[model samples]
Target: MMAATKRIALGAVVTALIAGLAGCSGLGTGGAGSAPGAGKESAPGAEGNSPAAAPKGAVNLIGDGSTAFTGAQPELPRAKRLKPGQKPPQFVVFSWDGAGEDSQKLFSHFRAVAKKYDAKMTYFLSGVYLLPEEKKELYNPPQHAAGRSDIGFNDTEGIRQTLAELRAAWLDGNEIGTHFNGHFCGPDGGVGTWSVEEWKSEISQAKAFVKSWKTNTPALKGEGPLPFDYDKELIGARTPCLEGQKNMVAAARTMGFRYDSSGVGNQVWPTKKDGIWDLPLQLVPVPGRAFETLSMDYNFMFNQSGTTQGDPDKHEYWGNQMRDGLLQAFDRAYSGNRAPLIIGNHFESWNGGTYMRAIEETIKTVCTKRDVQCVSFRQLADWLDAQDPATLARLGTLKVGQKPKPGWTAFLAGTAPGKAAVGPVPARPADQPAGKGPDGSGD
Candidate 1:
């Protein structure tokens, strides 16, 4: 049963969210339903939102006030400029797509895990999760019928749980980016077919859902608002199926997004595409395989299980394979170019939850290591923005597995690598496409 209809100062469900949804969702998850600690001073409504989350009082609402303008976010550490000759820290970003707290409660679970590790991650929220299933028709995604969504819709409880998790996630200093909506992947009018205007529409609807969930979810009128102003909080995203990246980047750049994680790249310093940071999923070593796969669980599962669950007996082996692959990638960077490592995941318990265990174990193994900083995409972007452009350009010259020829101080002293030393761009594949992402995350 849905929770009791709770009324607050927000008044009747506003009609703002009914406007054509222009949004998306990406990444994936399988979570438990427990309410995990948000790792902050517990709010008045610690079980979920805060008393001031909604408009019970006079709140300065931005735009149509679907979202309120809160003050500067807490706990964000100002980025520091890397000193000359100082080696860059190893950055590992653990991100989630389609982030929500369902019965699995993976959203909160991982938030807690990140807190335990002194890490902060990015959560790419699907706008639909904030829009109740009954109101699905309002979504009208491009290339799909009204109410049509590849990932289905959320129930009242699901929405409540997701809202709670999102509230906690943000307060804990994690990023809340978008995964868009509808999750239309594949050749049949997938994201690839979307025009720049269509992507803009998608992006708009994505923001609308978060901005005005109170209007769509009558039962949540008094649940309080999401912790931060999503408009200011959101600055990045990952595209579904990793398709339509070219077009998405074009659209996202104009929308003021700072970065995108929808492409496949080698583990190297990042660059810009369409003016937004192109933080692509990277190719990491896959144990027992000659070729590496994206640093995402879906890719590992796809390669190991052939898109099937695979042999139940081999689940452990598969899990270890993923763990080993990520570790190898981590070590290569920690000991090599010192470029940030980007790892993506979903919350679903695919392949008997082996991947989750692999990720959990990997987090324990490396997140606490010296000089390893498990950060969010936003924080990484901030740090990158604080660096010397010439330093980044120089660091970009180091290929994956290729250390600075002499050392970090000399190699990145604003000097270009030798033709042979630079090698091919590390972590980027030349022929990557838009839809090659793992089952639920990036290509």
Candidate 2:
């Protein structure tokens, strides 16, 4: 009798495994009238694990945010892809708001670091930073020092130079884009006493300035092989401060923007109100407080107070933490069929802290892990397009500026790969448009 019972139990276990793998799930079948085998399946929720779900992919791991505080993506190409057992992909970007000497140095450092990774960063420059002309004076007088630069603050010249550099970076396979002309909060909020309309003008001015650069630079001016591709020029942009959502989106579309990496973490698509794409920032973990809420503010780098400032002891500088958070978020997304993690940064922090160096080291370490790909914003946008049409369709239907839910954020926090499985593996073919191969280069 004992032997016969043992054989029956083995048969039942095999049957359950087969049924689970087959995805034999049902609705309203796990309650009072629950089926005999239904109770064994995992529960349903943001953190739930359905027995039928497919395994997550590793290459799907990602991080999004400003590279200015970290480094420039254009400089480093090899560091773009994350290999198996690697950390994550940190998509750093920039916001070119102030024309201070510190800001310029920050931008230069950003370019230098990105070169090391062969990645591209999205640069958001304001109109004031690129004024039509820097009203220079032959005589050095205190009169010209009123928010005016005796040195490099010419609107037109500054913007032209900035664009020229960005164009060069682009020619080298980097990325570029505009920040509103006025440096402020959303068009609704004022920045240093500027009004909404004034802010709008700043964005318009910045775009126009960039247009001129496209028409003037020898490498990028006309239809040239390296810099004159219409498709190439269409890929640059980040909001001034991720402000003026409605106005910024509408203006960018009117100005012919192809994609906008302004939003962070939250999945978005071209809005019905405006056709511009929203590349949201990735959710980065706070170094010491890896379980807290990720801040949406762009100035988190400038502010040294609170959790936004970051923890340096654990190598959790803003850049490291952000990148780590991004990896965790992407791991969660890959596991749950969600999208990539996005984060943004600025150049201000580069003036002092080890932001740039930290970012470079982190990228060198993380991007080569598992299936992570260190693509430019444009590349990411392209990969996004190649997603299953059904998935893209669902993404498209989502409204613009949809904030992440608390439950989802909590779920992402739980999936951090700190010494644990990084999660996911690239089952898709290498030539399938997302990444290269295990070598981190295209076949």
Error of 2 at 44 (Å): 35
Off by over 4 Å in 2: 1-104, 132-152, 155-164, 186-203, 211-226, 229-232, 264-274, 290-327, 330-338, 393-443
lDDT of 2: 0.36
- Per-model TM-score, in order, reads 0.82, 0.51
Model 2 residue 152 distance off true place after TM-score fit, in angstroms: 9.7
Each model's total of backbone clashes:
42, 65
Top lDDT hit? 1
For TM-score, the strongest prediction is: 1
Tens digits of per-residue lDDT, candidate 1, 248-272, equal 8888888879999987677778988
Give lDDT per model, in order: 0.72, 0.36
lDDT (tens digit, per residue) of candidate 2 on 91-128: 23322323212223445555666556544555544434
